[model samples]
Target: MPLRLPPLPALRFFEAAGRHQSFKLAAAELNVTPSAVSHGIVGLEEALGVELFVREPRGISLTATGADYLSYVSEAFSLIAIGTQRLPNHRANRPIALSCAPTFASRWLLPRLPLFRARWPKVNVTVDTSHRQVGFPVDGFDFAIRLSRAPVAGSAWTRLFGEQLVPVCSPGYLESLRDVQGTPLLSNATLIHVNAASEDWQTWLEATGAEHVDPDAGLRVDTIQLAFEAASMGLGVALGRRPLVNRDLESGALVQAAFNTVNSATAYWLVSAENADRRPELLDFRQWILAEAAQFSCDTSVDAAAAQ
Candidate 1:
């Protein structure tokens, strides 16, 4: 008069099949044959005394009971994942929550995320994209990618990269902005501004001596990448940052209007809680990220040579 539970193997097989809706693909993932997967599912169904799947030659479909049971199994597997992640020598089995400005994530890191995943797939990444200043230790983030002109005060900070701002637009957009003296002017299109960096546009205006132009009068965006994207789409001219839009320039999505680049003291920095060093995952991640930075240096050298 007691209820019975399906074996782990059978439940796993069912979960795989339910996920892919194909016994053969599930078999491939599990390194078993389609027939073996089917047999396991059959055993599971018999044990539960219910039909779990709608069998067909093309593929399998989950029945009502199968769907309901699959949800429970999926949750159980998730807990197992969390448990196994807690094992020693691993980054905390908990998700590695990261915070960064949306612009930085989209323009720079998102493009290179595949490399990060390939190197550390087990480290669960949860990104918080906000433009506001987040208190690093109080906000519960493993690391913070901050866009600032000054170093984060009262925190352990490391400079990730330096930034240089240049005037850029699409090739066609630049052509339109070109004058009789071949000076690329900002008379055409809307000047995109990252409202967060009020000094950026003013600095460019001062360096170029475009006194007649209003630095604040244009489309305002909160992030540098948005400015780049607007320029790319011919929305207007933008002050492109070297580290953020270098790849975009190389890819022809954007074109530098002039070689005049001003060094901006502000740059992205990596910061973490004071106690972050105590965790193995945090330490491993820091080392891995630093290694990635080294690789970028080598790659840039190779690219420079290839450009010649």
Candidate 2:
């Protein structure tokens, strides 16, 4: 009598597929075809005598049985990862892979990365900038930086900084929105929208009680970085998110179109697997980032006080 189990490869496919919820994305991660991932999942389901995924026209979702199995499978993989890393030949031998959002990566992380490198010359850092909410061990990332109002899903999270939404444009562009009296003219400016159903312009307007600019009318884009870039080119006034926009504002490449700063519920957070803190490099990175966040918070407070 032997303990029956599915093929290891099929199990891997199931785990990745469940984590990604898309066979195509799982295939890309595993360097295989989507059909292969789909087939492997089918085979896995057959072996377990239970349907793992509820396949729908738009996408697939886990059944109750599938979700339960996924938890067990994911935990097992995490345990295996911990065990393998503790091996004498494998310990501290891999690059610290970080999955971070592209906008945050460019605007905040990359700029401060040099200091981390300077502090820890031996630590190898690999950054994945794809705009996807990745899983922990399954996704092969040690840490992530997420921007959300709610707690970071699927991982432990530490608050980084809250956002201040301020309308901004280039210094030269600011002069164009005046009636020769240097009086503010919000309607005269185009609103560069980095809209993700968030309707940032509308949020800012409602928060500040400003009525001149039409939130619906603007140059629409998808990312905060792009909107600011367009604004820097003297195109229009973009809603600048603080911390992300702090660098550009400091550089004088962008100026506040209005003096109002609307506080947002969302904040940047450092997210990680439950066991990720065991790694020395990860611990060091966490410490450095926390310190940076604290300093930024202090600076923001000082700026606010000065404005008042």
Candidate 3:
């Protein structure tokens, strides 16, 4: 007996629409107008002889049958995606494209790329750095590094390392500050701020209970990198994240202020589309990156504990 299935386009429309629960969002993902998505879904419902969605004044929702059907359709697509990656030509000489924040790319990943390349000489990586949170498959990234406090949905997420704020400044600047027992008089020194992390200084101050420090009294810069550069020049103290400041600390350009390390709400996450591990390059890179992130986390933890 011949297999009975809905049209491929209709199925694609239904899957995207169902996944997003908004025709407008689904349209954006499908690179079509909202009307097109609505029409395609209507056609699909007609062909199936069942209403997939319940129309409402405010928005649309998946019916019970639609929810069940969507799961099966999504699973089928995932399987097909996995199978497509298995093609011989697909695995050969393809660079794993990575999307990440500019600051993270500059301060952390760029320095580590040499290590990744040495281990996987055959697998190349093309990194696109921006502050924008990119979409998988649509944005054409094999993987993305996101910094967030919340769990990622519609993708496979691997926690890399949590963030901590350390007040760091130059050795010269440190000598000028008065120390009370071990902790520095942070309120007396000039605070440096990164516009991107505008609240970080205030947040760190509150976390440490140094309410005396005027968070607003700081020289602001556009980026964290610049903030660090200024702090290293003895201008003011910049709140440095562990991964970003490790090199500076090692090089003796910056010293950590004697204060309680402020634990941040966010962490770095390695994210890829669900079931994207089927590709050899992605799998290899994922394995290698997870290992690197683990080691980094371990090293940073030890350092933090030692400091305390």
Computed on alpha carbons, the lDDT of every model, listed in order, comes to: 0.75, 0.85, 0.83
Task: Quote the RMSD, in angstroms, for model 2.
Answer: 2.2
RMSD, one per candidate, in order: 13.7, 2.2, 6.0
After the best TM-score superposition of candidate 1, give how far the Cα of residue 288 lies from its true spot, in angstroms. Answer: 2.5
Ordered from best to worst lDDT, the candidate numbers read: 2, 3, 1
- Candidate 2 stretches with Cα past 4 Å from truth are 197-199
Largest lDDT belongs to which candidate?
Answer: 2
Position 11, candidate 2: lDDT = 90
Error of 2 at 165 (Å): 1.1
Tens digit of per-residue lDDT, candidate 3, span 114-212: 998898788889998754445555445789998888766778888988887899999889877867564567777889888777348878878778767
In the range 1-308, model 1's lDDT, one tens digit per residue, is 88566798988798778877889877876789999999999998898899999988777899998899888887677566545444675544677777887767877777777777787787777788854444434345678887676785678888776566788889988888878987776655567888777457788778767656677788888767678878898988888886678888899989987666666777677887655686766787777766766666566556546745
Q: In candidate 1, residue 231 scores what lDDT?
A: 88
TM-score for each of the candidates: 0.61, 0.91, 0.70
What does candidate 2's lDDT look like per residue over 10-60, in tens digits?
Answer: 998988888888898889888899999999989888888999999999999
Better of 1 and 3 by lDDT: 3
Give the Å shift of residue 296 in candidate 3.
Answer: 1.4
